[model samples]
Target: MLDLDDTLFHESDFARSGFAAVGAHLENRLGVSDFASHCERLLKAGSRGRIFDQALAECGHHPTPDLIEELVDIYRSHKPSIQLPRDTVAFLEHVAGLPTALISDGPARMQRNKVVSLGLDKLIDKIVLTGEWPDGYGKPHPRAYGEVMQWSGRIGSDHVYIADNGSKDFIAPRALGWKTVQILRPGRVHDGVAPTAEHEAEFRIASLDEISLRRVLAGSR
Candidate 1:
C-alpha cells in the first residue's frame, strides 16, 4: 500500500498551486503586487480566513465577504497542477505485477482532485480516502488499514505499507503488523520530527529511486 501527500508528491506543491491561483486572483481583484509573500505567510500560518484576513491587512487591502468567498471557492476547487515524478514512475513500472493500494488522509473532494490530477488512480490498484470514512478514520486509525486488508483479502505479514509522515502514517499499520516503510523526501509537510519507536517504520528510503524488490521484501519480512 502507499500514502499520498508527501509520499507520492510534495504536498507543498498542492498548497503552492492553490496559493498561486489565489495570489493571482487576489492581485487581479485587489490590484496588488507581492502576492507571493502573502501566499508564503498563509502557508506558514496554515488557516484560510485568518491568513486571508492577515494577507489583506498586510497588503493594505480591506477584506470583503464576497472576495473571501470567491478565493475560498477557487482554492478548494482549482484544477491542481501536480505531476508524478520520474523516480515514482520507474518504481511503479518496476512493481507492475504487484497489486498496489493508496491510502490517504484529506477531504474527499480535495484528495480525489489530487489523485486525478496526478494520475495516481491509474498507477494504483486500490485507493481509500480515509478522510471520507465515517468519523474520519484516517491515519493512526485502524479502520482504513482494515478496509485495505479486506480489499486485498490479506493481513499481517501479507501486507506492506509505504508512506511518509511517520507521525501518523505508520501507527495503524504497525499495530496491524503490516510492514511499513518511510520514504524520506524533500519538503515534507510534517518535517523535522521522527515517528516514535512504536510508530516508526521498519525501513526507510530516500525516494522511489532507491526502491528495490529485495528491500521491499526484506522490510515486509
Candidate 2:
C-alpha cells in the first residue's frame, strides 16, 4: 500500500497549485493582487492553520469566516497541477505486478481529484480515502489497512505500506502487523520524528528510489 501527498509527490507542489487557484479567484473576484505569493511566503515561513487568513491580512484584506471558507473550498476543489517525480514513477513501475493500494486521508473530493490528477487510478488496484468513512476511521484507526488486507487477500507480514508521515502513517499499518517503510522525501511537509517506538516505521529510506522491492516483499527490515 501507499500514502498520498508527500509519499508519491511533493505536497508543496499541490499547495502551490491550490494557492495559485485561490489567488486567481481572489484577484478575479475581489481584486486582491498577489494573494498566491503571499500564501506561499507564509507557508515557507513555517506558518500553518492560518495561511489563507494571514495572506489575506498581508494583502490588506480582512478575512471573515465566510471568505476563509470560500477560499478553502476553492483551494480544495481546484484541479491540482502536480506530477510524480521520476523516482516515484520508476518505483511504481518496479512494483507494477504487485497488488498496489493507496490509503489517503482528506476530503473525498480533494483526495479523489489528486488521485485522478496523478493518474494513480490507472496504476493502483485499490484506494481508500478515509474521509469517505465516518469520523475516527482515519489514520491510527487501522480501518483502511484492514480494508486493504481484505482487498489484496494478503495477511500480516505480506503487506507492506510505503508512506511519508511517521506520526500517523505507520501506526495503523504497524499495529496490523503490516511492514511499514517511511520515505523521507525532501520538501515533505511532515518531518517530525515519531513520538514513540510503536509510532515509528520498521524501516526508513530517503526516497522511493531507495526501496528494495525484493526485500520489501520479503518483509525484511
Candidate 3:
C-alpha cells in the first residue's frame, strides 16, 4: 500500500505554496511593513497547508504559479520553524517492513528534494512523483493513482491513500476502490468542503502512529 504526504510527512508543500503566495503578495503590495509580520503569523498559525488560502482571503489577493515557486524556494531554505511530529518517524519505522510507496503531487523537483534531504528514500519502498510521469495528471484525476498501481503491480483495492487536503485531490482513487485515510491535522478549518460519503475508506486517524501498518496489509499476505 502507498501513503500520501501527511501519511508520511508532517507538512504539505503544496499547501505551503498557497501561503507563500500570500506572503509574496503582501511583500509586493504592502511593501515590507506590518503586513509582512501579519502574513508570517497567519502562515505559522495554520498547519502549513491552508495558510495561503487564509492569508489570501485576509489580504484579498489571488495566488499565481510564480508566487508559489518563490514560496517553495523560501520554504526550502527556512524549513526549521516547522516541527515534524514525533509520531511521523516512528510510524515510518513501523511500516518499514512492508512494501510501502510514497506517492505525492506538486513540484517534482521540490518533492524529490524533500525525499532525498528528509531521508525518505531510505525508508519507503518507492517514491512516485506524479509530475515525473508522462501524463502529469495529479491526484483526484485517477491517472496518477492508476499509474502508481500499475507500476507497483498492486490492484486499486489493495492500496490506501492518505492526505490532509481537499477531497477533490483524492476523489478519483476512492472511486477506483482504493482505501482512503484522511489525516486529521489540527487547525485545518473546513470551508464547506466535505469528505465524499461514498467509499470513504476503512478508517481515519489523527496520526500515522495510531494505525497499525501490519494490520492493514495483513490482507495482502
- Highest-scoring model, TM-score: 2
Ranking by TM-score: 2, 1, 3
Stretches > 4 Å off in candidate 2: 219-221
lDDT for model 1 comes to: 0.80
Clashes of 1: 0
lDDT of 1 at 118: 93
Query: Model 3 RMSD to the real structure?
Result: 5.6
TM-score-best of 2 and 3: 2
Error of 2 at 108 (Å): 0.9
Task: Report the C-alpha lDDT of model 2 over 112-207, residue by residue, as the tens digit.
Answer: 999999999999999899999999899878889998998888787888888888788888788788888989987777784788898998888988
The per-model lDDT (C-alpha) reads: 0.80, 0.90, 0.59
Report the C-alpha lDDT of model 1 over 172-220, residue by residue, as the tens digit: 8888888888888875667625557887888888797876656566664
Backbone clash count, each prediction separately: 0, 0, 2
Off by over 4 Å in 1: 41-53, 62-70
Position 53, candidate 3: lDDT? 49
Report the error of model 3 at residue 104, Å.
1.3
At residue 40, what lDDT does model 1 achieve?
76
| TM-score on alpha carbons, each prediction | 0.86, 0.97, 0.65
